[model samples]
Target: MTLSELIAQFRTLAFDKVEPYLFDDDSVIGWLNEAVKEACIRGQLLHECDDVDICQIAIKAGQVKYPTHPQLYEITHASLELTSINGGKRTPVCLVSFEEMDKADRDWRDDQDKHRLDPYFLIQHDTYVRLSRPTDEIGVLHLEVYRLPHKMSNDDDVPEIHLAHHEHLIDWALHKAFGVPDSEVFDLNKSEMAEQRFTNYFGFRPDSDLRRITRHDVPHTVKPFWV
Candidate 1:
């Protein structure tokens, strides 16, 4: 099954679990499906051939720790709890890309901020999307990263989601290996910190102008990324 289809089915089960919280079942389902689809696409294989289950393998193999999408929910929950956090001020959802880092970048890497090197822990299955507000003056954009488990052995289940397209397993290796945003870091000692951090983390560099600058204005009912 495609990611979207898989998630539609899972929504029923998830809704029952979170019925007391009044969480919007549809939105959660959409977000999860998107994560899975992205994961499969990055793997460059059909969902069935190389789905997110590889993420479980990564954990079992001691590659990384957690799924970025679900971890995002944790981040969102924390953001929501703070009265200081506002819609525009607080970072919106993060967009994850399911691509592995290049080895050339890895061999040449040399930076003091090894914490940013966390991308080595993540596989391509995990990424995130972040929304920016007018006041923040940043454009809405997706933040694709490698995700890893925080505390799990090599035998954990992979995070999965079914969208309309197919069922995809999360790339926990990429999720754990994600690069933190310059905004996320409290220090600003150098202008190259973010760039350096991404290199160390993902062993790749994104465009500097590519700062969080895209918006997910469309409804989840429509697949915007595909369009």
Candidate 2:
């Protein structure tokens, strides 16, 4: 596409016409590419949630990595765009930002202790590599998303609302991106479909008892809460 056309497409995507798609496995790395590159330029992208921990890992080992939010947004957006044009379905997904990561502090700290650092650093990381592949191809995976204005509980906060709204747009864009099948999408309860598909894609597994204990005792656990 021409640069102007690309920019127009991006504008449509940025202005509530699209949503993000994410992966279940980091090793797949099918979604990384332009998103991470864009994030690197925007300064919102990070290699790891905690650079200090990544540094430590690098000191001990030869390589280290993490995820960035912008990259996730970019890949999910790109994936949806690719799929939409190529006749595939799109799913709603988001990158865990520092704040989103912070919300699940207990889980993250525990992961740090066990894995030596949290794996699946950010959505950005996934798209970074995927976008860079020489084949100029994108991967396909299952996704389910819902319509907007998610019902909130009495105590839900502002960030949650913003994230939810943005996520909804990303989902909408996925349909545009993938030519989502009318039969397979948005006919039944959207939220139910999202939850069902998400659970199916992510799967459910019990956390280890030892990991739970470590998660409870991780130092400076609240630091990320403010992020």
Candidate 3:
């Protein structure tokens, strides 16, 4: 829904349709935008691999580390874009841990081969990427990743997530609205209940126990088995 429509609906549901609202338009909009972010991360709803700004990284010769997109939650796949050097052949790279690389080759971090072309493994911390082999020349890294939602500001702006998930986002806004600290309208009980309902639908958000949990809610969906 558009922000205006959603805000109106929120007022109706929140019983704040009357003027001198317990929540201001700015507050409601902020809560709604927060809801969008919570839903996106909790559900992995904003799956992005197509946008160049999100998926493509510019490589510097001999530079092994690169920053990831700020909104990224997890990277599912990555590869060095090799079209220019290997005649359009892409080289798929493995995601590895620092410890795993150290165990395999203790001096791996030395990066002696500045001219190395093929990278075998990649080490990705949440916000950075380190290549097994540094590039001989400038290159590109293509990544497949799950990202967070953008915050909405204007009344006409609708969330980027699928419309099916929009209605449920209200639960998060409700949770936040009632969660205001020490305000006359703040009710801890209402906040907790709203949060519980939000959790039931979106499977928990940034905090409150189940935050780190991953979901495979549908049938035939297997748990992630990353190597």
Which model is ahead, 1 or 2, in terms of TM-score? 1
Candidate lDDT (C-alpha), each: 0.29, 0.29, 0.79
lDDT of 2 by residue, 3-86 (tens): 223333434543423433221112111112222222232332233322232211111121223233321222222122223233
TM-score of 1: 0.19
- Listed in order, each prediction's TM-score against the native is 0.19, 0.17, 0.84
Q: What's the lDDT of the predicted structure labeled candidate 3? A: 0.79
The residue pairs in collision within model 3 are none
Cα RMSDs, all models: 23.3, 21.7, 5.6
Per-residue lDDT of candidate 1, residues 106-144 (tens digit) = 432233232231222212222432211111122222232
Per-residue lDDT value at 128 in model 3 = 85
Give one digit per residue, the lDDT tens place, for model 3 in 1-227.
99999999889888999999989999999989988888877788878889898899998876888998898776778877655556756677777677667877999777568655545677777678888877766778888888888888898999999888888888888888888885677888888998898889888556523322221111345688879
| Backbone clash count for every predicted candidate, in the order shown | 52, 25, 0
Please name the candidate that would achieve the greatest lDDT relative to the true structure: 3
Candidate 3 versus the native: TM-score? 0.84
Give me the candidate number with maximum TM-score.
3
Give the candidates in order of TM-score, highest first.
3, 1, 2
